[model samples]
Target: MTKHKCFLGLAILATLVATPAQAEEVSRKAADLMAQNSNSTDSVDQNSNNTQPPNTPLSPSLPSEPLYGGSDTASKLPASNYWYVSGSVGSASPGNDVQGSSIFNNKLNFALDSTSSWNIAGGYQRGNYRSELEISYSSFDVNNASIDTQSFPFSGNVSTTSILGNTYWDIPTGSKFRPYLGVGIGAGILSGKIKYQGQEADLGTGSSFAYQGKVGLEYELARKGNAFVEFKYLGIGKYQNDAGRDVTPPNSYGVNVGYRLGF
Candidate 1:
């Protein structure tokens, strides 16, 4: 009976010890499960943060094209308009066929000689065109004279001055040398004195309408200057002197050389 009682007491003590160990193992397993759940939740939160969208900008980016449809090369082109002035000197050949009425009511005719001519001008130029105001002067020597088909030895000098408005057009050749044509209309004054048989008569001074035509070739000397040579024809209208004598001046041909300058 004592042995049986001792065996029962040992069995009860073993049961108590086993109960505490089982409780400790259950607590440890619960802690491990909670830690695993917390790690999984943290991993999910980190992945959500990494996958979020970025912040937007305040304005859009600019385009790569140029503004206002303009190109870089077009801004570098030369100017197309400017102002200029010019002068020329030349030789003139007067026509021999000059006619007039003498005081004696006789038909008079004159033969003339060549002379020197000169001019100065100022103007504006645009593109291939030009317009100018010109003042010119020329002179002639009388070779001989005749009254009613009767010839005589005559010695005299005739001089003329003109003011003209001229326009010119330059032809494009895509070279430094350019060709041009011109026309002018204006007024002129003519004056002369003649001697025959020791008697001198004043042909007097007169004013008339005048006109001219020109053709020329220009050579570029620099950006601001050009040299030119030209041929021209000038004609003066009929003139009536103070003495009541009617006179018609002859046509004149000329060759000129000149320079033109620009600003």
Candidate 2:
């Protein structure tokens, strides 16, 4: 019976010790589970904060290049060329002597103001300098009697045509306007018919050298084109007869208006 009682005591002691050990093991496991859950939640929160939108990317920014200043971007702008047509009235003047009847000899003088005549022309130009080739035609009659002869009208018709080549240097003075000066050299053909004693006589007919000097202002009408007003002193030098006789020629001062098509 004592042996049995000893065995019972030992068995009861062992049961109590085992129960405490099992409870401690369960507590340690619970703590480890809580730690693992805490680590998982922190990872989820960090991932949500660190993410980027679908459209955004990681890269460095770049700078833009300027258009003005020494950059060639401004130089790439278009170039311009110009063309035009103009018209005006002008007068002829006495240049040299003619030989014929006493009243008809070397007698031509400047056309009367009433003898003003009309002309037409066309031209072309490029950049700051321009060149033009033109053809002009005019016909007018003048009656000038020597102060000595208060009696009769020195009546006749003088017709002239010219082909000229002109060049200009255009100076820019404003954003919308420019001033220009030019010179022209040309050849002129003059034909004179005199009505004397009810008979028509051809006095002088030939080609002569001519020239002009001009000044003008041009106002831009389009971004690449302009309108201009010009004043010129034109000299159509002396005409000579087929027989080498010199006759009156044309010299006139006039103003003209025209357009230029810029390049």
Per-residue lDDT of 1-263 in model 2, one digit per residue for the tens?
45445545655555577687775665565556666766888999998997787777587577866543311232332224546656555543433322223343443433432244555566755566778776666665656434333334556766767788988898855355778999989998888776756877675689889888889888766554567787777677766676566765656566666665533
- Cα lDDT tens digits, model 1, 1-263, are 45445545655555577687775665565556666766888999998888645685667688765332211222222222567789999999986567888777898887889989999998887767889999989888888999998999898878889899999987866555789999999998998888888889888899999999999998767664778999999999999998978888878999999998878
Candidate 2 C-alpha error for residue 123, in Å = 3.9
Top lDDT hit? 1
lDDT of 1 at 73: 22
Please give the TM-score that candidate 2 achieves against the real structure.
0.59
**Ten residues in sequence with the least summed lDDT for candidate 1:** 70-79
Global lDDT for candidate 2? 0.63
lDDT of each: 0.81, 0.63
The superposed Cα distance between candidate 2 and the true structure at residue 127, in angstroms, equals 1.8
TM-scores for every predicted model: 0.69, 0.59
CA-only RMSD, every prediction: 13.6, 11.5
